[model samples]
Target: MALSQLEVTGAEVYATQVGDRLTQRGHQVFYVSDTLSCPHKGQHFRLLFNKRSLPRRVWHVLYLIYLILRYKIQLVHAHSRASGWSSYVACKLTNTPMVTSVHGRQPVHRSRKKFHALGYHAVAVCENIAQQIIRDLGVPREQVSVVRNGVDSQQFSPLPAANNDKPIIQIIGRLTGPKGELVYQLLKQCIDLNTNKVQVVSGSHVDKRFAEFEDKVEFCGYSDNIRSTIAQADLIIGAGRVAMEALLCKKPVFAVGEAKALGYISLDNLPAALASNFGDVADDGKTELDIDYSNLAEQLASFGEQHQLSEQLVAAIKAEYDLDAVCQKLLETYQSAYVYTKQQEVPIIMYHRVTQDDSQKGAYGTYVTLERLEEHFQTIKRMGLSPITFSELAEIGLEHRFNHGKRYIILTFDDGYQDNFDLLLPLLKKYQFKAVIYAVTGTDHNRWDVEHPTKPDQRFELMSHQTMREIDQSGYVEIGGHTLNHPKLAELSEAEQQQEIEQNKAELESLLGRELTTFAYPYGNHNQQTKQLAKQAGYTFTVATDSGPIGMHQDLQQIRRIVMFPSTTKFGLWRKIKGNYTYKKASKQARQIDE
Candidate 1:
């Protein structure tokens, strides 16, 4: 069903577990990792080569391509930072679906160069990590899913607390860097833990230097019986999978690692703890070894008080972080990712005013006569193209919605003209077509457009707020943003740009009482700064005046649209939808008439 990019880490452990589960469900699974640590039954494994060896990395990619072709692999899931680079290239080259799981803190450096990681769909192990991926990696939030790493509840189930004179505190993880260094410092500082009976379940990969402190600790090096060993502890300290397993085992877990330390996984702190994926959240790389043994002891002293809390914590774990539930969501992601990567392009048609008379048609390209508008709808229906609103496209994603060779078209009207409500609404209902109308907030006319000297007076009135509300509340319409005051954004200062973009969004959301996530630039004029402002303003997708098909590969901001005029023929509309019409080449002639 899929392949994994792994190393000897918690990410690998998760990948192996998922692979094993997939195999159990009668799906063929393969794993690519640095080493085969605890091979799951009925699964195939391949070495990913040394991390630093360039030749081997190149060879790994080649091998992956071969595997994809040989096994007919449907998807590739990359884990951890090191494997992301190679797997990204391999999947992109092979035209395979790729999903990258951010299991821990990834300090990704921002680059102006093409973002290779952007192409792959992301699965953040936690909500905090998901937001980081969006902020740091510049990946859209829609492209990232929060699927926390899961633990086998049955295997790591809680046992009755063992009798002890004093409270015992333990740290569990591989004896290396983040976990190893932090645990080493904690072990040295807390000598009282020996009398309190501390146990270290060091994983298979151990630093030889850990032997120096062996006499001071009950070092259970490389234990296969982790659950039972963990069951014997009074209080558990660990990170990542260990922390999750500890929580499932009904222990007071102190999550400490390379990421931030979530002091304790309790009912009170459960929400915050879960958001950080039980302490695997990203920090600015400054968190040090800060242990709170007194706090741990205080919680341990009142075992009866924590009894109800323990039940709540376990219930939260099963509800949110259960292995079966997480994997079911992941399977859906895998299927969607495959379809998304192979999606076709769709044409977005833009209009402004629709009127019954041709009197105002020549005054500006904005006006399309009612007959022509009806003809356009008939032509679209005849061609089997389903009309959709921009919000619907944004909600479903261009790829997932348009992937199955489905002929879909978006109908967008700009400037909030009154004629749209009067003349266009009935046509839309007749055709059963969905449309998006971008309203310039608080405006009652196209006041931003200066009247042309040669054209007759075309008094273009805008739809009133009452009319906009009616159309917005209609199931067929989505009200989008055009700006508070329609101004050429490229000509405005950043502050003015913010006022235009952000203020429009705020005003519309306030008026509609629903999120306005799509925007259309005024006169289709904008710069890179304008796009940034729109994104910062929280618009999910923005449309520009440029003419081109909207494909899965297109950026959310600066989505292309084919603006129609009175002269645009049915044949021309057909050509445009088929991607054969060169609108840019014909813009001069159209501009001559409209301008």
Candidate 2:
């Protein structure tokens, strides 16, 4: 892997772990991380669930691109939900096979998480999880595989009979959150004055919690000999790496209430004892403990032989949840996915306004007036270029290259303006050109009321520029919804975003005798949600204000076009017809010297 692979996860520890694991198996792994994170035990990793902070999450996209390059990577694997999705998109870009190990639980799962879950090769820790992931989560059955976590039996074997030690009950956790206090309380509750001598050690002590527990317990904040800590202990309580380590150390444990259990496990199904904390429990009697701890003390008296815990955990290691096997499976997924990426052939052009003068001078491209537009139209006609709509070009040409002999162009305008009425209309009529205009829906309640170089609605057909109402009743216009507000699509709720598309389509179709099938992305900015909303709203094509010729690889909401203007000179316009628009001379501000 190259340093560029940093685009995928960006979690140094995750990258490091993945790197180290692959290296141990003779595969090279590249690592990149943007910033540090709070250390959880000895393992420091970035949080995947912070919804309010996006820049942190955005740091991983470049790593995603790194994954897209067809490297010899056999498989791709990730630990967290966000990283998993990031990896999937990147790997999918490269047609590489990929998979994710459900690392406990996601911190903040959104509704769109189902789509992320649907894309991966799922590997749960056990069959119970595998089945639940399939039933409750949207993970496809064909892609999901059950891989149990492993334990190092050699180093973590049961303690020797020669060393006589009192029953040491160990609970290990990052001494933060309620679990730290809960462990202390539960240990204080379960160990009896009548039966067992209790001793306790914690791996990670949240410093504040340490002050509180200083008088109550031994403050071994973290330990290098975690295996030994578990081996010496008669019983182990808590979850995560320490819990797994304890089991390998041949110690019995009360393993529950950590990530995999606290968030995912249904509390109601638990024995009136362990179920209270999925989110919050008020009247739900099944969540909190209703059982007597005094009775549980007697139960521990016969809690089987020493290391019986290790024996029972045999299946966990045997399940092949080891990183090696998991990575191998992941490689297969990436290979197939990377091979599947089609060449990025489609050009998604964007446009804004159609007139002779620039609305925002020297910022957006200059506008081409009617005289210049006619020159350009004549050139396209002479070149045998089909003036097709966004949908027609995509279908006839991009679909299996059916129209290989035909050069096609789509005409689109952004921000419904009036010059398109008086200025561009007659020109379109002269050339018999067909085009689509994404009208700003809210200005003057969607009407072209503003008077500019020309009066509104004089030359071109007025499309519904209504922000609140439908546009089809306007007769001469083809209603295309812009948005409720022209805010960037990335910064809106999925519901609000979807509503913008829907309200436009529904109102326009309702008013017009026809159906509304076109959409314009507000502010020419859209994210995954906006794209999805356009699809759900049933639009045939969506236009943006970017520069590219229209074609297929672009999503429905991201089709391309050229903005026609009023000030565009006829001689300059001819150059655009011959692809000068893409050349440096067209871009250069030239000064012709008089001879």
Candidate 3:
């Protein structure tokens, strides 16, 4: 595990436990942090400096490269954001796979957008953190997994119920935030009690509020052996890792943290408590808590005097969050990360017509203004992405032959319009780019416009055979079949689908004087039957208008493409290029439309 800081935090504790267990199981484990955190046998440890200094950060990256080369590191698991950032760069430089375990909500800044390309598969410690990484950090939900913190039930097991004599309530972890204030107030509420109570506070980052109660509470500043400290308490008031650990110790816990409280851990609310990450709830979803001091004190005293830990609760924790189970998940996540990193991601951008204006507003989404086309080209260039034709993608994907050392986007112009030849051809030539134009072979005009009820008067002209042939001859363009009359393939019979698909391929090949091997479904509409018909039609690959980035293992028949709208700006184009554009709403609406 690569951790930036070696402090005894939940993330570090998790790393330590995982490493110790893996090493015990005869796996070669290595630790890289500012300080060593291994608890068991000896293992390889490498020192990394603080991330605040630029030179030190670079050194850490270089050291990671060295470690990968020297130790042949198979996978890297980073525990903190600082370490994750540097490790991500190092892994990218060395072509190594990395997975990050975000223990808390990391700040989402604009600069971090560039790292999205690495596609660092994430293991968020909780569901809320998992959601935050997806919603806030722009990570794909498919790429992030939620593996909540697990506790060592063996190490923190419950003591016999006979020791419940005097109430000994403890508060653990960094004494800050609303949890800290709650702890302070709870301690004050119990200071004058005459029930022979003992209160213990254990953690680092002890706040100055403790100075006022120097003689009131027993402060165990910080201890590496927190499980032992937790075992000595009858009840615990904490949240997050502390709450989980205390529960493992068979102590009744009031799950309170950061302005939220679950009051007490019981069988009925156990599932919701775990889903809320053991009461360290997301700010927007925190449960309002009004802790009545006298009542809470009475409950704690009663628990110490009579209540025993529920066997059902202990059994659930062991079944769901056992250390062994969590370790196995980490191993599986690492293997997945390795494969995910190796898969080449290609984000296809689908364009239609490049027109001077949007005077014809019926299909405005398909028409990009000339200026926007130029902006898209420039944005693609600045992002260091080269344009490739569909044939090029097929060669790389199906054959695994050609190796282009740079990122690529398949620039496809669907429903080849005459404006594509006049307006888009120059931009393609200007950028020295390659593109595919899917042309409707049977008609010179969009006949559906005149026949359809939606746009009865909007009969936009499609590119003629002569124009498509000219474009194909340009060496920078490849012609693909877009059906004979641009009918929805799914709505047609199998024979009709084959006619629309196979006949269109034959017509395009006859016009271009070359074999047509690539196809695009008209209106971005297709089903399994439509795809199989395209395969039987002899086309090597086909594309759909699904909004997403393409991967190497993606279906050749149903390639995903992101639509480039007329309203797309330079920044929007950048987001599209990064495959981070927020187009879920647009994508859904697009699927509803024929095109």
Candidate 4:
């Protein structure tokens, strides 16, 4: 992880918490920052650089490159623009993966707009920041993920409110930038310091302007025990992390942040509060730091009677901002980035049916004879390509499997033709290769295509339940879900799609007595709704035919596959597997559509 500042900023705190959690999971984490804080267990390297100076920036880049090489870093998580700029260059030069977390609203400028160093995947701490990066920084929407800042629920659990005649209204944050100005205005004009026992907990020196209220307001300068400070407060005045921490502690929070002021966080206004990251952002895209003083004063005045925390609000916070869930998302993102960086593409070869007779070749050109299948297997072995299942590929990342520069391909047999069990299983055992069979659990034949009047010869027998179980236990074939019955998912209603997808998964898991992780779209036809249903059905990956993002990791739910036909020659299959076949095929189809 690379952070521009080593101070106790939100970004720094987030990185520290993430680093600690990752370390506990038995992963090595390294930090490169402006200074050495070493708050967690990790190797910290300092590479200070002035953002505007060319010489210093170049020096930082070289130092980052050295650190990456020395530590043999697998991925870099950049936190700020200063570190992002340098770390991005180093990652590009070294061929290492990097994911940048947009901690807050970024300043818009020509250079920043043109070349935002958000790495391979940009992680936004909130939806507001994600929008800003995509709109102003010109980042591709697909490359960005909105992962909110997480709070350790255990460490900051709810505490009983202090019983005081005067409520302790504590404002916590660094008294600088727009936040400091907002704090000054709120203290000077908005709140009644005499009636309410106000406290300011900041790392910065108390401004001279705050001298008049010094006696009335308690200025606790930079206490390390932030949770203790928060526990003492009756009402927390902050935004982003502070608001999240306070909410987790079951305290009333006046949502005031650097961007704008959202009066108070309640169950009714919680959605709005979350949309703006508890007021660290303005959802309307307005930059003005406006605060409704009258409304703030009213909320403060009736704080005791109106500002009661609810269990629902606490549950919402825990659901969205739990440290474990957030870390899991980050870890998944890291794995994807690492895979993408390590291997740009993996050939997912798709096959439908294998037969012994050329007379049974269907009109759809979806089958290859057993002789040809064996020839293809020989070619695969001769080319030194190993066939692996999707589950294996996902569990063991590309780097580990591709060690010693070994190449691999995923072999998928769709529709689970009976020949897969009788014919393909022998070849798989002969070569000791693994394959995935996407089985439609509700049927025993290709009725969807065979029942068509124009495609009578396409009739093929699907594997029976006993055959499926036998193949699944063979240790060489993984049975994936292919829906309850093959249907054009795009033409189905949402409920129908859900039923087809979920029911197929449930039945398959029950029959196989194990969970299925991958699903293939029937006829490679799906819409956004179908894809979402597949995800909601718990399939980690869903395959599509020749239509998906250029990279497999780009969209896991809609991965591209190479369709192998009976006429596909050895050289053609090799080209399709080794070359950029998906991209070329997609481009050709796009051109034909345009023409």
lDDT of 3 by residue, 1-595 (tens): 8887644567777888888887765466777888764364445565665655888888888888998888877678888777777888889898788888887665667976546532368887777777776777688888888887867888878764325465566777666655666777777774343454445455556678777766656777777787767666666777788877777777787776654566678888787677667766563533345556677666555554545669888778667678888987876666445435654346677887777877754543568888878988888898888888867766554322212245777789988888889988998999998999899877788776567776564667887778888889998898999998889999999999999998888888888888886889877898899989998888887888863223323467887777788898999878776643323434456678856
> For candidate 2, what is the lDDT?
0.48
Q: What is the number of backbone collisions in each predicted candidate, taken in the order shown? A: 0, 45, 0, 0
**How well is each residue in 419-497 modelled by candidate 4, as lDDT tens digits?**
9998999999999999999999777888887777775655689888888999999999999989888899999999999
Model 3 TM-score on a 0 to 1 scale: 0.54
Query: Candidate 1 residues 466-491, lDDT tens each?
Result: 88888998787899999987889999
Q: Is candidate 1 or candidate 3 better by lDDT?
A: 3
Give per-residue CA lDDT, model 2, range 1-595, as digits (tens): 2121112222223345445554665444543222333122222333333332567546555445653453344345665565665666666666555656653433324564457533446655445445555555555787676544433445565564324345555555544455555555555565552344444554343455345545556656545556655655566655544444454454555544433232111122322212222212222223243435455455555543433433435335323324456555444444333322322222223344455544323233434545455666777687676555554554453332322244555566555556555555566666666555555544433233233235443223333334213322322234466765455777878887777677756655654446666788765688878877887788877776543232333345665433445544445444444433432321232322221
Rank by TM-score (best first): 4, 1, 3, 2
| Arranged by lDDT, best first | 4, 3, 1, 2
Please identify which of the two predictions, 1 or 4, would achieve the higher TM-score against the true structure.
Answer: 4
lDDT of each: 0.72, 0.48, 0.73, 0.84
In Å, residue 446's CA in model 2 sits off its true spot by 81
Show the lowest summed lDDT stretch of 10 residues, model 3: 396-405
